[model samples]
Target chain A: MESVILQIAARHMRPLLVILSLVVLYRGHNEPGGGFIGGLMLGAAYILFAMGFGVQKTQKSIPVSPVILTGIGLLLALASGLIAVLMGHVFMTGEWTTLFSGTSFELKLGTPLLFDLGVYFTVAGMLMLVMFSIMEE
Target chain B: MLVLPILLPLFFMVVLIFTRRWLAFQQIFSLLATVILTFFSAMLLIDVQQNGIATMQVGSWIAPYGITLVADLLSAIMLVTVAFIGVVIMIYSPGFIDKGRQSAGYYPLAFGLLMGVNGAFITGDIFNLYVWYEVMLTSSFVLIALGGSAEQLRGSIKYVTINFVASIFFVAAIGILYGLTGTLNMADLAYKLRTIDHIPYINSALMLFFIAFSIKSALFPFFFWLPASYHTPPIPITALFAGTLTKVGIYTMFRFYSLFIVENLVFWKTFIIVIAGLTMTIGVLMAASQYDIRKILSFHIISQVGYMVMGLGIFTVGGIAGAIYFTIHNMLSKTNTFLAGGLVYQRSGSYDLKHLGGLYKASPLLALLFFIPAMSLAGIPPLPGFFGKFFLIKGGFEAGDYVITGVAILVGLFTLFSMVKIWNEAYWKKEPENIKHGRVSRRAIAATSLLALAVILLGLFAGPVSQITLEAANQVVFPEMYINAVLGR
Candidate 1:
């Protein structure tokens, strides 16, 4: 934890890990990766930082408490499911629209994606919360 | 519509999580949510009763292919009973739960538990049922240890460890069943089990399920964890768990028993009957030896569960209906007894019956509140418990299972003896000198009275309630109807 090399390594690896996790999250709707794995990766990034900087520092750097983060995640997931109800579809039905389209390329978004994003936040926040609590002890 | 019962609590639980810092807001919002939940479940029961079984494929997927939620008469009844109990507990909790635990996510965890219970009641997929059990168990594990006292931590450790072992058994059984049948939809599995002539190790899988559910329901040998853990929490949490948790296991047992255990009936029938009798005799005998009021009631929960399983063992329309009815009565009365015990603790500053006395004079209303549920639990006339047992005993006699029928009746007497023991020690004995008295809040009393009122109403409306349960039992007894409802055949 005190080694300069390890600290320096953690700083650079965290951003790369976070970016890779985002890529995983974005590709999950139709592929192998999903929110759960992406969130775990993101949590691992935070874990690396905590290992280098200590839990108190990590807690201070985070914008909000983990409790609020988890709550917000649940709200987002519920909101995604509820949006379908507002759209007069069944609860949690995938309501999709193409965000961008071309002859050879297209991007689509749906409530399922929002649901996945919610899971990503929740899992990451919960993991950090547990890790921080255990580490602080 | 079917999704609402599960969704509403989950939505409200999230809201409560956000509002956890606001104790007053949490309490009021929780009461409001539980009231709405009760109304929704009541409407669900009414709708099902009027229209027959309700089925919904979530996300508009086909029943067998995607997740399905079904509310037959039995599930609806369970939903309604649990929702009503939720409302009562919400009302009781504010006065009983201290500020520390209240602010520490008590309300949110409660809703989480409610959501899980609702999910378990309605889910038509076996794997989804396991998921719901996890949700329910996780919330309960937290609630049981919220205060984190030495005693509570001890209780929670045993509770969590034993329950986790039971869950492992559940998953193992699910894996085996899925490998053999290739479907996790409950009705689909039931359909296949009936169609296929031979499936190796199916009975072993059934035994695994039996072990898992019996542990959950706290039947006989697996019940040791319940009495060990139930009394450690604050009385409100204990009250909530007493009312709804084990009953979910019983409900699932009934559901699975009706759907899947038809072929091995002869062997399993004798097996269940023996276990039921032992559960009743052992639980009551242990209860009779306890001086702590909470421990006595905790043991009684085990014994009462035995009655429901006894009816299950009988395996007739009358028997299943009686089991359902007994389940409803037990949930209401068990909670009432615990809440009343909380009130006793409020006034006496103790849960030890030896340290309590003269409550009948100290507060006549408290005495009456405890008396109502106590008598009902003891199977007195003009109470729902009587009819529940009467129907079970009648079914047993009808089916010529006379030995266990006699055992049930004797257990009923033993049950009365336990209740009378509590009454004498807590309400009738002379108060010891120099005892400090605490205030019993009017709100808590009123909340408890509401439960007592429910028990009385259940007794008064036993006719109609039994009619509904009989219809529910009919649905369970005839799995073809349920299979058709889920499979759309």
Candidate 2:
């Protein structure tokens, strides 16, 4: 169902799109790009792959089912909220910890980032699940 | 913590999701989770009763800025009621739902719906309420079509379409509200609304809210989707929804009405009264004509919701208290009636009353189980429904709304007639020829009996329960108390 040129383009675009989506997801804590946008990009990569390659081939490449990925994503998001409960803070209060603080290259991590990552996986998985189900059908 | 009722469901949702492959594990774990949810919800209610209103700021943020989870008496009561219903549904599901369906993410989806309902009940911010509504809708969209039956799928399409429209209206209203008040926190919005009395868009936003909540709660004009879609799902799922879903809309309506829009109080009260009258009259009249058990009960849900709204329209402490009590009573009895209908279907292999007969002779226990909730719903003396009606009517008369009170009284008669119609057709008549009976699960039957007992106890302890609801109503009727609790003003 696919042309050779289209297939070649999808093959290169898939990895690049995934890398861009991951970058978007990581920088989402402080910048404008966040889980939702990154998740869409990740999902778009799969959708592109599915369109170029056959549905069965794309299914074979996915390591886990989209449904399970959504479950894992929900768990991660819930765990991020639970962190505050554990620290004797209110539920969902963001707890930030500095990584490489004294160095010139310092990064900050927090539950908000974890929550964004969860949203990232959830949206990606949900999008893939819907798109794949439709395409396969 | 006040947040536990909302969080417990999410935790169980993940557990159920990972365990969806094992039906046995999912069932047991779900049951345990519902039990814990109920316990915690009851504890919250007790805490709210002992020490005034309880508010928890999510993530340790300030009340006006962050999402606040408030467990005032009203939310606490609703939490307990919803959680109790969840426990009953979890117990009832294992027996009613097939193994294949159970393994196909039923438990997880059910908990997802629960999480949404709990979140909706306790959220102190208006936008958070909308988010929870989406959560509930997403789970419901799947759950309604879970069986993959042709008719079920068809019904789900209508259900999904109608609810999405309601959500659009809801979100649009929120947009207007946020634009007008510059705040999303309900308490803060209420405080701001009092100072700005000249805004005309407030009515439009409120009208939008009324339409949205009315649709979600399935009031008279917007009720067609409920009876059409509710019967398509299996009995346990239908009963789960029958007990919890519409009440969320009603809860929000009460919350918003009691707290916001003080400038239009008289107008909203009159509008609510008119809607309440039409809703009850139309809803009961529709129920009187339905032959199918689930359809009858489904229509009855609309009528009973009218009673709650009527209580709201009465606009007194007694009236709102009555509405709260009526809500709790309806949750128990309505779910009980649906489960009893499921049992009838189990023993007779049909939901159509015309094809059903002689259950009184065949199973007196089932007959008794059906009788208790049915009579309670019909508002028989010494039942909670009677007291619910009593409170609402007394409050209505006190408020000098005799016409609506009369409508409420007459609706009671029609409600009784419908209950009697089912009683006669399903239990009193002889068994129809060629009827095939399936084995009824003892666990499901036990769950039904336990729910019926709750109805009975609600009546027996009406004195104490009413006292609590009245206190809750005091907070509901006064926005200052709620705002003070939330903002420490």
Candidate 3:
């Protein structure tokens, strides 16, 4: 017996929560939010969806396994570190680039951002894995 | 290059997480990774020998602020030993581990354990050491409980709870030490601590570190968890743990004591001497009473660790060199003994001595393999253990510590007696009539023989090995060289 109201609220809130998490992840390097917090928010959003719609429905929606996601995340982080080593610098020495240095709202990119993205995926995937396993039990 | 030893296994672990479904791939890939790591570590050892202590500041951050990976001679030798044991265990595992546990992420967890061990060996920051210890402990917890048997669970619970408390104590000490010194870089702490004149607080912090490491290293009163838990894991896992885990604790104790905590030598010396005597005597006496092969071997680990601590207690170059040499010998011998015990279990179908007999008749080759490490462990002449014990005893005599020298020699004799008891009960006695025996797996034979060969070579060539350990001892005693290397002075 699922609560219809809770389901409706979850349906309405998930997109917003996901978008907010992305915003947090994007601004993490310069602001208070970071990969771990953003990932937690993203995990919370999916967990909320699962809670309202049931784990089976959530699993059908996202067919990929969490373990694979964790693997990808770890590889990404490792690659980010190895990129520096390949360039003959120390491991994990951040490499930076500016996409539009002359513009007011310039886009900046770096290995640190890549590393954070890896952490985000790892945390989100790991939390969901734990949550779904517990929910199944 | 400094990161390769750590990063390689970590990468393999992540790769293993995905390849867990492919048993053959998992086995082959993990074995390849360990072999590569062993080569890399040996290369690193040689490089460090040439370069005079390799130091890497992570992410290009300068020392004293950033995380550092530093490998002096002590760290280099430890890394080489760990990687070698890891290779041996990987070779031993496919034949030893059951299929159920193999599919349950054993390879990943083993690599995780290696990552932590290597990280602990190389990290130059104190807080990072704590973090690496946590990494090691988490994986060990999983490995110990991998099978989910009642005994395994009970042992893991005891192991986890005690180690968790020790970790807490470790972090608390780190916190207090950080508070007092305002730095966590170990070399910087050494520098800062020398300038600070607060003896009482420093002594208190050192005591906390002593208690925490004592538990991890299985020192006298804190060693109950080791004997209770070690026999519960799979044979290969137990052998790996026997070879590496407690030695990490001892390594940290050696690192911190010789590097930063030597100023208060008087208190530590007397304290270590008392603990060493009690630990050696009590561990051997307890091993004499245990009938289980793994349990007896586990108890002897604690006893042998006492000799290392006794060397440290002596606080001289000869003493530390002895400790390092003993550590290397014990790591190989202990692992081999466990592997031999596993082989015996494979052949005889029981670890209980009362229910076992006639291994000598069943397999003369197995008896010889077991004898090499067992006698070597008992400090037989022309073996590595004898030289290790000799150095420690000689150091004790030179330091005017006759009492500990006496206790060490007595412990060695009892160790021999217990080894002989196993010989008498398991190897010499008649086989039980109804028991069926199986041939030991070739893989198991290969792994044990590799370690046995290493034992022989180390014994036959104790000169160069002792030279290396003496160099390590010199680096340990003189922290200034270590500080200069890590801090770029």
Candidate 4:
């Protein structure tokens, strides 16, 4: 019965939590929210869904396995570093470009943000993997 | 860039994690990754040999403010040695590591271990070194506990607890040093330390670093954890640990002593000499009593490390060169011995000397493969270990340190005695009536033979190798080149 109430609440809360996590991840470099916290928040949301809908269902909801997610995250982070080397800089040296220039503030993208995104995915995937394994046990 | 060696392994580790379910793919891919890494490291070594030193600042930050990766002759040599060992062990591991462990993330963790090791060897900042040490400790902790067996758990607990404490002390020292000097860049710190007046806090920081590194290197009075735990892991893991892990600690000691603590060696010289003497005598004496093959090898590691420290304690160019040479020889010899011991365990189904017998009659080829490294480890003539010991003793005599020199020669005899004990018990004794002999795999034998060949080659080419080590030693003695390379002077 408790699970049913949780399931109903989770159905609405999951999307909101995921969106908020994205917002946190996107604003991480300039604001208080960053990859680690955003990843943890995303993982927490999935864990809540799992608690309500069962681990197997939650696993099916995510297209990739959590461990694979971690691998992808690491690859992304490493690629960010490699990109700098290719640009004739040292490994992991951040390279920035103006994506969209504006009068007030430019939409700038850089390797550091990519690295943070990689960290976000890694942390989220690792926490989720740990949670799912423990729940299964 | 200087980061390729480290990054390659990390990338492979992540890929291995994704391919864990596909056993064949994981095996093949891991092997491929190791091969590529070996090539990359060799290239790096050659490049550094030609270019003096390679330094890269991560994220475009200047030296002293950013994390820098620097590969001098010492780091490049160590990197190549580590990569070579990684390749041989990776080849030997497929038949050795169980299928369950493989599927459960062995390859990924192994690569993670390599990543940590490479990172430690290349980092130019002290705090960054601490971070790399943590990375290494974490991966090693998982590798040791992979099976979750009772013995493994016991060993892993001890290993983790001791190393964790050591790391805490390491970080604390780094914090104090950073607070005092306002920099963590080793070259920058060297410059800063020279300009400042002697302070009591600097001595305290040095002492803290000494204790922390001593534990990691398994120096005397802090080495009990090594023998208690090293034999509990699987043979391949043990072999890898024997080759690479503790050496990182010793390397750090060499680096720190040469760069930061050289000015204050008068305060710590005798202390290091005494520790070296104790570490040598006690480690070999304990090895003589151990019945398990791996345990015996583990104790000798401490003994051999003592020899290297004795070189540093002597504090001369020849002494440091001898230490570097001995380090290279020991890394190969020790890993080969453990690999050969693993083969013995495989054939006899036991690591106990009492239960093992008659390997000589069963496998003469294996016997010879084992003999080369075993005797080399015992400082047999024409082998690398003999030259390493000779130079060290000569260095000791040159320094007029007769007492430690005598202790070193005495310790060498005991090391030979322990090696002979293994030969007598494992190869000469008659096989027990009920013992079953398993056929050793071709890959294991091939891997052992490859390392044995390396030992032989190093011995045969001692002149050129000695030259390289001499150059490396000179670099260690003078930190200006390292500083200039990193800071772009």
Largest lDDT belongs to which candidate?
1
Model 3 agreement with the true structure over B1-489: per-residue lDDT tens digits: 899888998899899998889999998898899999999999999998888999999999998999999999999999999999998998889988899999888998899899999999999999999999988998898899997889998999999999999998999999898887789999988877677775458777888998999999999999999999999988999999999999999999888987787576788889999999999999999999999999999999999999989988887888899999999999999999999999998898889999999989989999998999999999998989899899889889998999999999999999999999888888999988877677688998999999999999989999999999999999998889998888888
For candidate 1, give the docking quality class from DockQ: medium
User: Candidate 4, residues B272-303: lDDT per residue as tens digits?
Assistant: 99999999999999999999999999999999
Regions of model 2 farther than 4 Å from truth: A1-6, A54-56
Could you give candidate 2's per-residue lDDT for residues A1-137 as a string of tens digits?
77898799889999999999999999887788999999999999988998999778987888988888888889999999989888988878899999999999898899999999999999998899879977986
Q: For residues B290-378, what per-residue lDDT tens digits would candidate 2 score against the true structure? A: 99999999999999999999999988998999999999999999999999999998888999988999999989999999999999999
Least lDDT summed over 10 consecutive residues: which range in candidate 1 chain B? Answer: B434-443
lDDT of 3 at A37: 92
Determine the TM-score of chain B of model 2: 0.99
* lDDT of each residue in A1-137, candidate 3, tens digit only: 69999899988899999899989998999989888899899888889999999988986777567777777777888988988988889999999889989989899999988998888887888788779977976
Worst 10 residues of 2 chain B by lDDT: B192-201
Per-model tally of clashing residue pairs: 0, 3, 0, 1
How well is each residue in B1-489 modelled by candidate 1, as lDDT tens digits? 899899899889888887788899998999999999999999999999999999988887787998999999999999999999999888888898899999988998899899999999999999999999998999999899997889999999999999999999999999999998899999999999999997888988989999999999999899999999999999989999999899999999999999999676889899999999999999999999999999999999999999999999999999999999999999999999999999999999999987889998888889999999999999998988898899899999998999999999999999999999999999998888876699997778988999999999999999999999999999999999899999999
**What lDDT would candidate 4 get against the real structure?**
0.90
The alpha-carbon interface RMSD of model 1 comes to 1.0
Screening candidate 1 with a backbone cut-off below 3 angstroms (N, C-alpha, C), the clashing residue pairs are: none
- DockQ (C-alpha based) per candidate is 0.73, 0.85, 0.75, 0.76
Q: Which has the higher lDDT value, candidate number 1 or candidate number 4?
A: 1
Stretches of candidate 1 exceeding 4 Å from the true structure: A1-12, A103-105
